[model samples]
Target: MGPSTSAPRPRSCGAPSAGVMIPHKTKRGEAALARLKTYEGVPPPYDKTKRLVIPDALKVLRLQPGHKYCLLGELSKEVGWNYHDTIRELEEKRKEKAKVAYERRKQLAKLRLKAEATAEEKLGSQLDILTPIKY
Candidate 1:
C-alpha cells in the first residue's frame, strides 16, 4: 500500500506496537497453526510437480505453438513439446500394468499347481473305486 514497485513484495513481520503478535500459547494461535502447514520451512500451497497426460499436453502445446515450453528451466526443447509429467505418468501406468500382470501370473501358477495335485489324487483313487468292470 506504500508505493507500487516492479519488484516482488518482501517478507516483513507485524509491528510490535500493533498488538499483531499473538502469543503462540493462546488457543487462537493454536487454531491458526493447525490451519496452516509448512514444508521445508515454507508455507503450504507450494509449487510442485504437476501431473498432465502427454496427449493432453501435446494438444496444449499445439494450441499455442509459440510460447516456449521449458521443464524445470534445466532441460531445453529436446523433449517433444516439453511434456514433463506425461511421460512420467505413462511410465507409472506401464509399471502398474506389469505389476498386475505379475500378480495374475502368480495366482495362475498357484491354481494350476492345486489343480494338478487334485487331479493326481483323483486318478490314484479311481483304481480302487472302479475296479475292472466285469460284464
Candidate 2:
C-alpha cells in the first residue's frame, strides 16, 4: 500500500512546530475578536429628572415596621433600640419559618418515595406473570 496522504493536524496548545507553520493571531487581534463575539444591547440612558419620595413611604407602601427594615433596609426610627430589636426578631422568625418548611418538604418526599417503592414491589410480580414470554 502507498503512503497515506492526510492533512497535517494543528497542535492542541502552545507554539506550533516547524512542520506546521500556522499563522497565529496576536494578543490584540485575539482580544478584538473576543470583544466582537460578546455583543451587549445598549440600555436606555437613566432619567435624572426622576425623584423618589422617602418620607411616609412605609405607610404608602402598606408594609409593616419589620418589613421596612427587612425589604427596604430602612429603619423605623433614625436611632433607637426598638428598631434594632424589631429587625433582629423579624429576621430570626423568617429563618425559623424557612427551616421548618424545608424539613416538612424533606419528610413528605421520604414518605412519598417509600409509598411508591411498596406499590412497585406489589405490582412487579403480578405484571411479570400476566405478560407471556415469547421464545
Candidate 3:
C-alpha cells in the first residue's frame, strides 16, 4: 500500500492556545478578552484583598518528576513575549507598594503620638482645676 498523505492530527485540541493567538471578532468576545487581559499589579479595589490559590493548578503540584512540560510563560517568551521585563515591572510595583505602606504607617504613628499628647494635656488641666489652690 502507498504511504498515507493525510496531515497528522494534533494530540490535544482545545481553546486555550487559540484564545491567546486569535483576536476576538465579536464585540462581546472583545469585551471579554479585554476583561481577561493581565494587569501590571493588583487593581486598586483588589490590592488589599486576599487572592485565591488553587492547589491543583500550581505547577509544582501538577508537574510530575522527570516529566517534560513547558510553562505557559515560557511558551509565550518563545513566541517573542518579553517575560523578564514583565517580571521586573511587577517587582518594581511590589517595592513601590511596600514603600507607600511603610510611609503610611509612619505617618499614622506620628498622628497617634500627637493625639496621646493632647489627651495627656487635657487630663493634666482637668486635674489642676480639681486640685485645691493653697496660695
The numbered model that scores best in lDDT is 3
Q: Estimate, for each residue in 1-135, the C-alpha lDDT of model 2 and write its tens digit.
A: 135643221221112232134323667655544443211111123221233668765575666556533322232233221344555566576667667877998999999999978977888877676558623
TM-score of each: 0.34, 0.35, 0.37
Candidate 2: Cα lDDT at 44: 23
* TM-score between model 1 and native: 0.34
lDDT of each residue in 1-135, candidate 1, tens digit only: 234533221111112212345565789876665554322212223222233467764756566778665432124224222433554566576667667877998999999999978877878967566558724
Q: For model 3, how does the per-residue alpha-carbon lDDT over 1-135 read when each residue is reduced to its tens digit?
A: 135543221211223454666667878767766565444335567765546799998988988989998744445446454544666577688767878887998999999999978977888867676558525
Residue pairs whose backbone atoms clash in candidate 3: none
Displacement of residue 35 (Cα, Å) in model 1 is: 59
How does residue 69 of candidate 3 score in lDDT?
87
For candidate 3, the per-residue lDDT at 43 reads: 52
| For model 2, the run of ten residues with the poorest summed lDDT | 38-47
Superposed on all Cα atoms, model 3 deviates from the true structure by an RMSD in Å of 11.9
Model 3: residue 87 alpha-carbon error in angstroms: 4.2
Q: Relative to the unseen true structure, what is the C-alpha lDDT of residue 107 in candidate 3, on a scale of 0 to 100?
A: 100
Q: Name the runs in model 2 displaced over 4 angstroms.
A: 1-82, 126-135
What TM-score quantifies how close candidate 3 is to the native fold?
Answer: 0.37
For model 2, the local distance difference test gives: 0.47
Q: Which candidate is the best by TM-score?
A: 3
